[model samples]
Target: MMATGGRRRSSESDELELGSSGESEEEMEDSSEDDQENEAEIQRLEEQLSISAYDYNCHVDLIKLLRQEGELEKLRSARQKMSELFPLTEELWLDWLKDEIRMAEKASDRENVYELFEKAIKDYICPEIWLEYAQYSIGGIGQQGGIEKARGIFDRALTAVGLHMTKGVAIWEAFREFENAILGTLQPSAGSILTPEQQEMVNAQLDRIHKLFKRQLGVPLLDMETTYAEYEEWADEPDEFVTQVYKKAQQQMEKRKPYEENLLAADPPKLAEYQAYIDFEVKDGDPARIQIIFERALSENCLVPDLWARLTLYLDRQLKIKDLVVSAHERAVRNCPWIVGLWKRYLLALERHQAEHKIIIETFEKALNAGFIQATDYVELWQAFLDYLRRRVNFSQDSSQELEELRSAFSRGVDYLKQDIEQRFGESGDPSCTILQNWARIEARLCKNIQKARELWDRIMTKGNATYANMWLEYYNLERAHGDPQHCRKALHRAVQCTTDYPEHVCDMLLAFERLEGSLEDWDLAVEKTETRLNRVNQQRTKAAEKEALLTKQEEEKNVQRKKGRSEKKAAKRAQKQALPGDKRKADQEEWGAQIDQPNKKPRAGELEEAEEEDMSAECGLFGRENNTRILETPALQKQKAAAAARNKVLHDNSKDDLTVFVSNLSYSIANPEERLKEVFESFGHITDIRPVYSNRGLFRGYCYVEFQEEKAAADALRLDRQELEGRPMFVSPCVDKAKNPEFKVLLLESVMIILFF
Candidate 1:
């Protein structure tokens, strides 16, 4: 089959390439040999579709297989069914349209083909389809009014897509070529001048061409300079107004070029780039540019409901054009019918546009059958329709068709949720019974139908709502608003009997109500009712508490067993690491150090502080603990500090003790420790590095070394000493070798958490 019309369509070779995939002889032979297997696979897809009609990939597969087997009728049926369920993508629509156009060319009845184009265009704003439609119209130019019809299509095509910057130039060029072709037909023999009457017809035709150029130039389309060049070549001196229009369009294009460049560089589904472009256009306050960019974005990202929403929202709030707003909303639902919010807005937009009752109902029915992913979407859509119906009814009057319609809709919607939605999703999505609540309110307040309202409330409570205090409050509030005091009192008695989650609150509300609207006898009766209920509830709570205590004891025993198991498993892992071969890198042994599995515990029995302080300096990087006892016992930390000591010996870039500040006493749980220190200390001077010390198990040790460019920067940073951070005062002191400067330390307080470092 040949793909024809505009350049956007595939060439004959490209179509053949596309068609060859379906016509592979080896594939056909395989299908022939495994006919039963192919049939079984097709059956599986069909069964899946029956189970879930919104299985999009299943439909595409079925269509492809049917087409491969030359089952044209079945393929057509499959594609039609899919299009009815959801909007077909551009590629799918293009292939379907090409096939239909091929059939239409062979047959005489082209009206079906025309109707197909209309349906295809409604799916999305595609310049390719509009261009094809206009080009297809040119085939019948010899018929009466056929030329006029073709020109009308060209005009509509320009209107729909002329604002598209990237590919819009193609449509403009196509339209101009069409006019030039017609202009050629009107010209006389070579070098011939016409009479006044014929010349007038010629001038009118020339003026039409001039207007097309003028209109095309006014839009800020890509490659618009070429169109200007064409006009300059056509008319020796272009009109001053047209030139100015061209200049303004170029200025707008220049302003939009960077955004377009971003879109070009971005991959398909350029949602982020398009969003940025849209925000810029919106800020630029050009509705035309905003709409064009949004359309371009949605072309690849139609599945995203948010993009559709932003476009429709802008149309609704800013554009304020009924046709555009309604069309955008309808397209939104068509592309994403599963989205409840889009359908909700579609309904509201229809009502805002005063769409006829029949169309609104039809759209609502379509929404109900759209195969929403969750049951809640169906309920919300129903609520929106019910709101529409309720508003239409004239509640002031006794009765009307509008009132009956609203009542009928409410009944059907309630049944749909209670039965259909429940069966589908295993629960009515409306757990609050919001639709029933709304209906009850309408019955009691609007029509003064107290008995009907009571019936609705009774239905509401029976659906597991009787145990909720809010449900009882809703019913009591309704009765107080419309019914008498007896109903309200009766409602409270039923609530106290049935409400479970918060029966005490209902009882209190009952007492308060009696104080306001009941007699002394009623008040006494309410008090007795409350006391009896509270006594029973308290007894039930005591038993529950005893049961919970037993569960707690069992849980504690399980936790103790789990902790023992984890400790044994960790012990085994440490033993295995210690058995590693000598060939293992030293870093491995350093990482999994001896005593790495142990925590530094406090002094036990008769450990003398004086003896621990004397042993602290015996090791290279041994440091004092809070009570001046040697604490850091990990071999990995000792090795690491020895490396730091070697680094200090080199005197690299003058990064010695004077240029470094020891940051300590911060909370161990401080997040992003080094970065936070940089933020706090970099103001003094350029920071070289921030080394936040961590425990062997990768926990922050509540200390780090901050190295600066100069000694004065370190001195300046000392102003932050004892400054509180993360609920602890920081200790900023010079980074010194504790063995060399034992007396430089002011004091080691036993009461304070002390960390001595090198």
Candidate 2:
């Protein structure tokens, strides 16, 4: 209900006038209502921040709301909280700086503003912030610090972003103006030359201004021509070195202009262009320029953890500025706290720099609470923290505070995995229990405390790890390295009893251990134990194998019985139907979709004509037989028939004579023989019809008749004679009744033409 500036619009508000019937009578009442709504909204935003500290937009919205209501304290808190997690934008920093500057009353408040400026510049290289910083420092010149402090800030600002292509000129100009302002104050009189000391003061101030101008001109930035022209106008005499530096800077600026122009032409967070720009700066081999470009890119793409990581890597490897490297890592983790790698890298960076023990521990605690998505991330983070703690321990000293802390962290991590991690992720992330393994190793190898190590290994096995042969071997190896032969033999004996996955490997390990360190009776006992365990395991496996084989045999017999029953039932039904059938043609027509063919048995002489004559008489006509029979044709059958006709009409319907090729010797198990035959001979010419012969049960009978569009196409198709269909060579012969056409012979074509003109 709280209005977001002017964005919250409603139809009711649009319909109402200023003094509408439902309007508040007094402006004070209306204002109080808005204040309450804003208060509620502020509370909601703050609550959201509490729930999700990394909610970047929520923080920004809260800060904006607080600033709008002039809740100075709340605004400061909101901005600080947001900046702790995310690098603030230049706009947010400017707003924050301006507010601090306006509210700052005492010398101490001014110093706080200075500290705020320092934090702001670290987030991004904003010349405006630098300009603001310099200007703010100018106000403090008379209060406590003198002009030198202001000059020092301006100089640092120029050093940071002085090589900036477009905005670097602003900082240079501001520095010069501040120096000029100081110069004016240092001059004794308006018309007379100063005394030696005073004159020296004025000259030194002029030299500072000169050096700033020279530095500005030497750097490749936007509006260098303006700087050069201004320099020409201001200097009493021309300096060729300055001119050459200006020319060189101009050339460099021209080279950089295209990239900056692309940045301006593209949208915000132009990552691709910025990457190309970063490559350009890095190729120049200037650390200062590379760092500046990286900061500029990060200003827009702060949420991009990769960008921050790259910047930090570059600083660590190339620049080696400790503050910048630490800041980069810290900011990377802030921007991407959920990224475990970033947190790990931050811990390393902090430790590499030998940061305070308290700060490092605090950072590790924050990483533990960073709410990583994967349970493995938590495991890895704990491992990192444990490694840091272990590094701090003096192994030479038997008992140290660092060693105690490390041991405590180890126990705490294991407990956390058991209760918290397993509850959240449904299983402990460390399936191998690497943390416990490390702890045992540390206790054995560093503390030389085999008893403690043995205790740890016992816990490891009890935590759902008893069955693993590898774990047993791991414990055995550790005991062998750090414990006595008696303990080693004990560990191996327990391993042989408990190892299930590879009991033979552990048995062999125990035999090897007994050979090296056991007496004759001890070796005899070990052999007996090994033989018994192997015999039991082999017996159990043999029984399981026999049971599995029996079950498989039973399954096969059941399958055969079921299949025979289905065949017998089908046979009986078919026989009864054939015996009781009224009209064979009608039955064939009804089962047309199934393509059930008539029986292959030869009929008695004249029996077919007699049956046809009787069927015709009963239906009044053969073509009108549908009226008397239960003939059914679904859309799928019709579509199949239509597709058959579209490819080529059947041979009986065509006018062409002797164009049908009889194809035989196809694979009986081949499905869709018509389509398969067509594919084999389709390259010859247009196919007229493909009729695959099927038996009464609708099974392929290994033969079909393919009628072509022309006799030549049929002749060409005959060239595929003995060519394979479904791995069986087929006979593609002309469709001739041998008794009727004795003279007909299948002459293989040496050359053939498909007669499409026919």
Candidate 3:
């Protein structure tokens, strides 16, 4: 029992000690919990203080929290507090006004809300603050009130900002926000109040946006991709801000649906679709539709000739009749005469139709009149006409008399063409070889007069510089046809001359000439001409080598001259630098030394005299050396000789006079100089002196003049003029009759009119 009691006491003491320790730990835990609560409270207070430090930030936070909590009234309360706390800050005032707007909108008081926002924005000078306020008001009062209120608000803000117009950032931001407000209100669902013209203005603005930033709202498919980012930035807002974007997309999709369906439902081509088609006689060929497209294309802002021509081709393909095809082509030509391809196609179609000779002739003349058939085209047309004649006339079937009559007609046409070409050549002596050759060939083949043909060709080659390869070939063919060896040889020589400077042409023409002659001399001459042409080509190729050699020599000489010039400049600079400084220093030191020596020097009678004598000798010797060095002679006589040589060269160059003058007496009169001048003459000297006594294009002065080197020559020309020249006589006489020679003033007036006519 005693042991049990002792053990129990000890256990009780230990338990007690343990309980005390537990109590201490419990107290510490309680203290720690209290400290935690105190710290949390302090942190909460610090956060509240920091948030409410700026009234603007405080109002914003409160509004955000109230909105999250669905307590708009509390948001209003906080915003009011913010406005009262900082009434001068438009941000706080705007926030308060926006909260009021939210409340008013919640109560369906749109007018009151708009008025509040409008007043706040107007009274606010801060663009950014007012802009933000306007955006928030938009959220509460919907787009109409928001946009209307915003436009007025922003206009005032802009006017206020105008005072500080140099503030570009503020001005641009205001404009951007204004545009945003306008865009936000632009939804069909938002119930826009725009009239038709106002809607059009909005649409135009939207189109401009889409065009400038293609991927944004209203861009075309063809717009470039570079605009995507810009469009994305402008459109990177909540759906509420960009509500009408999807509506536009839907409208676009809806507009395209019918066209797309029409395109899709279009049937595969069927022969039956070509209806109203006389030839193919099918249904639904859509010729009328194609014609409509053609007409529409013709009516486009700028007519496209190619498109019109293509449409005509489409119509012809659909109709599938040669007559309709030709008709459509002719219609296109009449409509668009400047379209050469269409005209050509029309001509081709006419050929296909096998039009009568008279019709073809009329068509050709009409084409020429319309300025559609160029020289080359005329050649093609002529060939086609000949082919037609060959096919229809059947020379073997026709009698010799008919054949001769046909040849006579061809001769008349050739004569007309030769006269035309000769007139042109007389006007402009250097006529194109192509026209000349065409004229010659037409005469040769159709006229069937070999002499006339040869004369035409000779005239062409002599006058038109007809050295083309084809000319030589034509000449050779003519010679071969005439069975003239000398003519053939002459043509071959001309061919050689034509190819003399071109090695490739030489090789080809020489070989051809050899083949024509079939002689060893011909072959040898060909080889010689070809080798000479080749050597000439080589020399020409080496011309660059000579130029390079000259350039290299010039470069080396330039380098030498540059180096010498640089060295001379450096020497002159150094000499000038050295001479100035040395002379200055020597003069200063000599003056000082002389002053010192003069004061200290003393002399006996004979010693002073000898010293003076020695000084005089030294000065004389220095002066003599300076004079000898400075008095060098220049070679001006050499320049005088050069000038004399140049003068003599000028004298020699001017020693000859190559000009000769022949004066005509105005007293010698041609009765009708205009009529006589119009008469054809082969040479310039055909009339001794031809002068028109006309004042204008058609009027004639009474007295006319003509003179010749010999008086009898003048008389003979006057007789011919009277007999054959345009049915009028030209007066001719010596200048002894001074009455016919009018005063200079009268002559000047007539001459002025003549100049005007000419």
Best by lDDT: 1
Q: Where does model 1 exceed 4 Å of error? A: 1-54, 62-78, 105-108, 538-758
Q: Write the per-residue lDDT of candidate 3 for residues 309-357, one digit (tens) a residue.
A: 6656775556657655766665555555544566556655676677666
Q: Which ten residues in a row have the lowest lDDT in candidate 2?
A: 749-758
Instruction: Specify the highest-TM-score model's number.
Output: 1
How does candidate 3 fare on TM-score? 0.31
For every model shown, what is its TM-score relative to the native structure? 0.68, 0.66, 0.31
After superposing candidate 2 on the true structure, give the runs of residues whose Cα lies further than 4 Å from its correct spot.
1-32, 47-54, 84-86, 184-198, 250-262, 518-758
- Note each model's CA RMSD in angstroms: 17.0, 20.5, 42.3
- Report the C-alpha lDDT of model 2 over 284-387, residue by residue, as the tens digit: 88888898899889878877878888888787788766788898888788777788988888888889888999999999999988889889999999999999
- lDDT leaderboard ranking: 1, 2, 3
